[model samples]
Target: MRFQLLGPLSIAEGEDAVVLKPSKPSSLLAALLIHPGSVVSTGYLLRALWDEDQPATARAALQSCVLRLRRLFTKYGVTGSLIEAVPGGYRMNADADTLDLVRFRTLVRAADGAADAESELYRLKEALTLWQGPLLANVPSPMLHRDEVPGLTEERLRALERACDIELALGRCRQVLVDVWEAARRHPGRERFSEQLIEALYRTGRQSEALSEYRSVKGRLEEELGIDPGPGLQRLELAILRGDDLGPAAVDQAVPLPGRAPLALAEGPARPALAAAPAPADTPAAALPSAPASVPPVPLPVLPARLPVPPVPSFTGRAAERAAINASLTARDPGAATVVVLSGAPGIGKTALALQTAHDCQEGFPGGVFILAMTRPDGSSVTPAEAMADLPAPGTAAGRILLVLDDVTGADQVRPLLPAAAGGAAVVTSRRGLAGLVATHGGTVHRLSTLEPEESLELLAATLGPARVNAEPAAARELARICGHFPLSLRIAAARLLTRPGLRIDDCVAWLAEDLPARLSLADDPRMSVPHVFGGALHRLEPRWQEAFRRLGDQLGEHEGLLLSSGTLGGSAEAEEALERLADAGLLEEGPPGPYRIHQLLKIYARRHAREWNRSRTATAPH
Candidate 1:
């Protein structure tokens, strides 16, 4: 029996083929087969099966679907039990002989290790052929299609790129024209394919066509992405226009394949010849062409412009905040630079929002989007001078640049790093309100608060899947509320539930409510703990401010919405200062007028600390 996942979901034995009926079973089978021989977690399978609208009895329904898949396999004469029920989920047993995906990967690996160009090209073409159409085209699972299909498609395209490169190297430019042309057309934004298509056209004696292809791609990029072609594509066009030697040296210099070594082409006048290969490791240095001063030094390759920010796959909400930041970053005003400060409490998704905004507004900043960590991993602050060293030198990149100063400890730390050029932009994210930075630099300070109820639910659905969340809508909402609607806390809660597939939403809520801010941590990742995040913020406060925070927490217990007047903290001028300080640190939210309120989770955390402080004070008394 053979499982086919390179295209649509199907099983075949010899000439007989069968596609599992019903979308749920097909989705289940695809999920299991994707990770053959490994357990597909029950939580993942549930999400794949139902997406957002899971029934209450999803677990039982999942079991029924698995049983149906097994029976279908048996009805089609698939030998043995291909599907195995593991402890937490199901696993499909398959190998290169039984699965098309596995076979495709095997061929690609073989190509990677091939000694000759012909052998490598053959294996790559074979692997490419296995991709009949869009991956799992008939599989009706939005979760699978969204997450799994794109990566698989990317693998096929990379393999195709490698095969076409080899064909060009072997002086078979005419043969590769069709594949390269189709690929460039299909994926216009992918510059690598466009680069290859141009080279193939130029080598085929169609220089005008090659130049025209470059113009088309340039126009498309400017129209869609609002950016010019990358340095490599521009260089390739220049080389063609100069009518320079479009040899292996020029071609390789113009467009280098990532993760691929320079190809050694067959010797021919029409075909561009590769530079001389280095002598074998065993050869004596005296036999080489190097004689110290006589040997020309190799120039360092220029690195591409890229933002170091991590990908936020499950980022959700803050639509208004995102729009505000986008406008501030992308606003074109040559007279004034843009500096947007995102200030909020720890774990409120400050960095996530900043990075997402950077990615969204990347087109406006053509020079590059650079992210500098203003705080080190150990919680020490990064000095302004040290942070400035990470950015491009003054007036280097042609276009305007955007710098992201993340986790800033003070306004002073970011002052030196701010872009001096007009039209430049920077985004600063920190726990403290950095009002001084905004006051000095004249930028917008977006003080983030907890996410709205619907936004929090949307975040939970994105991470935990809509099926499980929608199954117990009330419990899910309560869970979000218990998490204080903070992005970090909600994410931690979602992680806990995801790791424990059998834990019910209401039961998890009960467990969290019993010992929140503490139970809100994942044991594996200490970074994901709410207590750790809150503790860090508390640690940053002075002793007096810390005491004020604890006392406020103790006094505000069980009544989260009760606004606190200055009288609650002795009604003195000093008391008002303390409240303002706490609010600035994001430990308190200043309500209408002079009163303030604390988040429910923060209140619980603060109360826990306040009791500890009181007990210690009693024990240390002279009595």
Candidate 2:
């Protein structure tokens, strides 16, 4: 007899399949099968049977459910003693031959041990094929579904991702398209799948469809999650647009196989020493004696440090900020490590500036340049411990290292990961002013603002060429003004023009002027969207500050270059504090003495939310 838990709970012997009629027995069976070969405690079984509403006879009721499951199994010709009443609990004795879930795991393990890509691909495909649908879809158990189903589903997805990686690596793009398309469609929120789908589509001679799919993904993400596609998806779109050579190597660089360390930095001409060297190959196996178990294991060799940051080829501004960062990082301070915190509004080019600086100062730090993402791809905070583990081992690099902690939420998140080595430095970028970090770490903070007008124009001219921007000089200036001179918005606007060669600057400016923040988004990249980026900054603030920002925008909408005092918004001291906090969060810019300024694009975003809030308030008001 075979038990299948990959999908619906069922029993099969030869060509016959059996389903448990009663929900209790099915739930009990599912609970046992979830931990096949291991004992599942009675307490857990009872909870699974009757979640939060256990009867006085719950223990006895669980036994009765187990009996019903056994009887059903026997009726279906299942072998004897499959469900054993172990001490304090029940254990379902299932092997690869008896359970599809067990078989799937066994196949995956075999694939992990497979000698070649072809063998691994075969085993992974076989493992994936066993998953018929959602885990235990027919088993009606809220407990099992809540706790166990998600993990089982993730296991299947990881396997599917691996299988697709192998297929792409093997140059079977056409073969991978069918599975990738379905995966991307079903899991639109998963950027990795979208990236793979885009690559597969592009590689299969469907470039336009690939670009369209990116736009669809960007739209869905914006509409559903109020965010943009991650850096990976954005980079993939740019690569496709450039018609770059996206062979197997490019695919690996773009998506990276899940669960592995990202590709290491190039070692240049000089190779660093390894942590441990291998034994001489000429030594015979019989002559070599293994070290005692008490002996410490040899550490693995450390590869060259690699920052996953992409180059900013068209980077144009931040001359002073770049010089300050370079001086801080390169200064020979043997007593303490340097920390330079770059705080700015979302999409104000903190990261771009950091990347450009790191590249420029690469020669100063002989140890290496490394990047630690403080936020996960899903936009959740990565714990400091996990971030530390992702770093190269201490003393692994040859000399002083430079670490870039990207998208940091707070000073505390960065404190533990700061380099302890003398002469080392860290460049931290965040949406909020990390004053606490500076207080503790003794570093300088550079608060980034919008680009200068000439700088913004230079960025546009650099990207779209001087001839294009100079042709319609006034229109170009208007475009920059509409973009609020924000680097990210400017880049998005420039990318749009670069793609559409024939679109006139004045016409583009007119289109953006109608709905500045909403139209500032690029179809291919979410991070470039004016509203999306500003929304993230707004969402991070306290509720009161968020409301204050929205209300302030509503009052100042389309009133360019206008300044509002805190007293004007609200007379209370709490209102003043809220305004100060909003300014710290980069949502509002502080004037010389007391007033606050909101960017034109940011004001548009705020006004929209303010209108929404007003409607919501009206609807919820007493009739």
Quantify all predictions' global Cα lDDT against the true fold. Answer: 0.75, 0.74
TM-score of each: 0.57, 0.55
How far out, in Å, is residue 195 in model 2? 12
Cα lDDT over the full model 2: 0.74
Output the worst ten-in-a-row residue range by lDDT, candidate 1.
249-258
Give the winner by lDDT. Answer: 1
How far residue 431's Cα lies from its native spot in candidate 2, in Å, is 1.6
lDDT, model 2, position 559: 55
Per-residue CA lDDT of candidate 1, range 210-230, in tens?
899999999988898899998
Q: What is the lDDT of residue 580 in candidate 1?
A: 81
Candidate 2 residues lying further than 4 Å off, grouped into runs, are: 1-298, 305-311, 420-422, 591-593, 619-623
